[model samples]
Target: MNQPEILQLFRVEEKRSKSSLRQLFAVVWAQLKMMLAYKSWLVMDLLSTLASVVMYYFVGLQVDPHQLSRSGWGTSYLAFSLVGVATSNYLWACLTRLSHSIQHEIRGGTLETIAVTPINMLMFFIGLTARGYLVSLIYLVGVFTVGVYGLGAKLSFTPQSLFVFIILFVLMLVSNQALGLVAAGIIMVYKRGDPLVFILAAVNEFLAGVLYPLELLKRFPALQVLSMLFPYTYALDGMRRVLILGASVFDVNVLTDILVLGVFSMLLVPLGLKMLGWGYDRIRREGTTSSY
Candidate 1:
């Protein structure tokens, strides 16, 4: 082949390789545009985040610092609760956004059309959920910033600690995606709200230590056992230790958390995919793919 012809061929191949990424970006951009169209909701979301920070700050103040340290987190209650709050936001996004997106597509009569497209179905759902996950990360950062500056919450992070924190955060996201897929699958087949999502949310709030330390749950063995089943319990605890306590990834407890989260991701990802495919097939067969 001529030099110019070879160059042209390579360009085409590059474009083909990037097609999936382009599609993913398109999905995220569409969601962002839709969100921006409702300027009021965006503003209200920010205000609500601020309100949460204020409420949590005051509540944390009521808890003695000595008692917070005694809980084994080695930080003030405000700082510890900040991490829990931030992590829980991502969990909420995962639990609701994927299922809601599917419901929205069905009610809008676009589910069938999209299902017929050549793009990967899993990637499409991932892209849809990615927008909400990104927004939740923004909310997390905003809340933490407000806590540090406005609420007098101390957040100390060295470069090493920050690196460990990012690794754990990514693992948490992958682990949470499994739960999102299961929720999405439930929504697809049922064509109605999934009670599991609400149940999980309540369980996470009360049992997963979003607002308090899981150490308290140790007193109640049943509740502690239930909390252990949800990966967020470990995630929030590990994150607080690494970020606030300056623990290393190799620390015994931190390493255990990583191993557990990694195992959950490996097991759940395939199971989630299988369940989603089964659910989609059932809906298609029942002629309800586009039904709300």
Candidate 2:
């Protein structure tokens, strides 16, 4: 192609990209506005986050810091626990909380309206994920602060490490959101909302290494294998490597974890989308947009 022609094509592509981004931001903004409408619920969510920090603080006091640090962690017990707590809260927000939004719509018979919207379903779903991300960030900040002031843990502050940490954290978020989408698919098909959430929460409590190392599960090979598949397991460990252990991405086992999370997100997102579409079609065929 001639230079002029190529330039024109580039201009057109840029404009389209800008327009797509604008639309995505608009959708995200609308979802945030809807979330804000539930002011009391938002406050309660914040309080719950703060409560987690307080609970962890007291629990830390009961454990001997020397014993926790003696286990070759290099950091104080509070520092180690804070990373686990923050990442765990993010996992809960992304997976357990976000999974229920679509189910609520289905139960209220409003999911049909969503299917009819011209907005891209993928964009809409991801936009909704921002609410959970923001809520999780609130909790992370609270717990992290508690680790610093309430528990007297020193943080290693380096710009490069911070950037790498945030990137990995966001990738972990995407992976959890993908799992949430899968949970949403089950809700779409079976209309059963609470079971997956409960099961996942219980499993994470023991297996995600929130309070202990995964090596502690050696006696339970089946549980160990299952826990290895959870994105939160890697995320919690990676966060500790960055935030507490002062390890760079090159020094840490981040690549393997990132690869696993990437694969999960790439595979499950499409499957979940297809399943949700099928559920929407079924409801439309029955003319039950607003019917439970």
User: Which candidate has the top score in lDDT?
Assistant: 1
| Alpha-carbon lDDT of model 2 | 0.71
Cand. 1 TM to true fold: 0.90
For candidate 1, lDDT tens digit of each residue in 148-262? 8888887767788888888888888888778888878878998776677878777876787888778887789999998889877778777888978888988998899888889
Each model's lDDT comes to: 0.83, 0.71
Clashing pairs in 1: none
* Candidate 1 deviant stretches above 4 angstroms: 1-18
Worst 10 residues of 2 by lDDT: 13-22
Error of 1 at 279 (Å): 1.3
For each candidate in turn, the TM-score is 0.90, 0.81
Off by over 4 Å in 2: 1-23, 286-288
- Residues 211-287 of candidate 2 have per-residue lDDT tens digits of 77566677899999999878778777776777777878787386676667677678766776776567656656777
TM-score for candidate 2: 0.81
Number of colliding residue pairs in each model: 0, 0
